[model samples]
Target: MTGPSAVPPVTVLPVGGHGLLVELPTAEAAEALHAELLRRRRTGTLPPVREIVPGARTVLLEGLAEPRRLAEELPHWRVPPLSRTGGTAVRIPVRYDGPDLAEVAALWGLSEQEVGAVHASAEYRVAFCGFAPGFGYLTVLGAGYEVPRRASPRTRVPAGAVGLAGAYTGIYPRSSPGGWQLIGTAVDTVLWDPERTPAALLEPGTRVRFEPVDSAGTPIGDSADPDIPDPDIPDTPSGSREPR
Candidate 1:
């Protein structure tokens, strides 16, 4: 009996009766697969699409009338040239003032200004969005800056708080309980704008940059965090970063 699980690189795993998790080798591969699947859904090549949640190394395709049928079409999935080529670029101006900035500097062996310089100088892309609506996990394009999450999460993290955990950086779209090491905060861009059409300002494959800005939206000057004792990070990237 040839079931839908027969494929070359894809491995289908059941996520209850209503969902299916498609596993890929790397984070980039999963993103590429999600992009392709989204393209298929948009062009009516696949069945009525439902929730398509992409993670670090997996894509969740839920609410399918028949996941097995969709799985049968898996091996043939492909992304077009233009969709793969161009991405939406967005620049988010931020203030390099966070409670955990000192610790991150201590861990990475850099001053606060140096920390801000290192961060603002990098080109990051939305690798995946999770944890909350509008919260996109950004990936550093070049030699990545890796920082662990807080050993013990804070009771509450403010909205627009820019943080780093694992190999990814992200902005808290709203006030929420979180543990990611806060590095900065966005100036003006609305993250999860429910009034807007798409809502989330960031999406997978979207190019992003953290432009350092001051209170009046002018260019920021150098600064450093005071020395403090703080430590703790999840063992893996997408481990236990859930709000509780």
Candidate 2:
């Protein structure tokens, strides 16, 4: 159930309907496992596991004929490393015109320009996926940008909305009710047919940078934004960044 510090811990528990609960160190680790399982299923090493659900720090493995078989198989399973260049970067145009824009600025004691810099300045890691389908809770926003969620969540947060709450930032995959402070918007298709390859544009461990746009939601100029390497992806420590 536990591995060395370098290795992630694995726990096997029973959820209703015979699901195997696997606790991971972080969502990133769980994601790596999910991808690895998919790869193994294709390559024919691991047996067909079903309903691989990812959570904040847990991965639920379902449809194992016998829970003991899962426990024995766990020792042979390890999270695989994804290709450094295997994933694509998704660019989203943001209008930078949210109603809470000014409020967020004052909360962090930053000018509107400074606030924009913090949001657009760094690449974020998809730390975990939660709250809704296709919604990513990205980690490592510019340092001083940690703002709490709104006192009350919006009745309907439009799809493609880019918002920040606590130390995380995310895009609304659909029109969902939530409390993250809206800052901008992303037009990228966050969700679609789950049966399709690369079902979601955002994958775990992938990097993303916010590009500021105008009222029309077009790029700053001809729509080009520099890519910042995901500092959290590597073992190296991430540099300091301003808060959201």
Candidate 3:
């Protein structure tokens, strides 16, 4: 069946012994299928599987007892476009002073301040989580905010660094090498905590917004204090690469 874009049909391929990789034409379509799978599984209509991992344009289902049977059935299941507004809302305070902020502004054809304004105005969703434990690949609801990755990969990117690459915006969970364009730094946010229930602050399907703030934890361009709550939990050290 055709996906949300309706340009191409869904393709399911066998992965390893018990996994099936379902590919779609677009990230939005993948999200739709992922949501549908979750709904069916919750309602006891889907087959048993160990994991359903969503990616930019694909969903990887692992631990299937009958991969070939499910693969044949996946192409016939109709899934609607995911609702952009559905998900848990999270606001992250960012200090727009990254090393690559000026570069990103020039690419966007806007001033440094305007860049922050534009980036902060968009509502983003966690399309998937990969590369690192707490790193989430966040995508905007609409189009036209794409950015190219850095020409040269950095030897080390500090934890809390907010970056943009292609259609995704991600934060570095810990210090590691990366190529994403750094646009800002998340303030008073713990990206990963082993002690936390979910460990990662940003999970797949979570809605996110960036709130521009200055030093001392006050909202920029306004007198009101956002009173952004501190994560307060100790971070777990990780050597994983930054999320793409």
Top model number, lDDT: 3
**Candidate 1 Cα errors over 4 Å, as ranges:** 1-8, 76-85, 141-144, 220-244
Q: Whole-model lDDT, candidate 1?
A: 0.75
lDDT of each: 0.75, 0.67, 0.81
lDDT of 3 at 8: 51
Show where candidate 3 strays beyond 4 Å.
1-8, 141-144, 222-244
TM-scores vs. true structure, each candidate: 0.80, 0.74, 0.84
Q: Per-residue CA lDDT of candidate 3, range 158-226, in tens?
A: 999999998889999999999999989999999999899888999888889888998776788732224
- Pairs in clash, predicted candidate 3: none
Superposed Cα deviation of residue 238, candidate 3 (Å): 42
Instruction: Flag clash pairs in model 2.
Output: 142-241, 142-242, 143-241, 143-242, 144-242, 144-243, 145-243, 145-244
What TM-score does model 2 achieve against the real structure? 0.74
Name the regions of candidate 2 deviating beyond 4 angstroms. Answer: 1-5, 81-84, 125-130, 142-144, 188-199, 203-207, 221-244
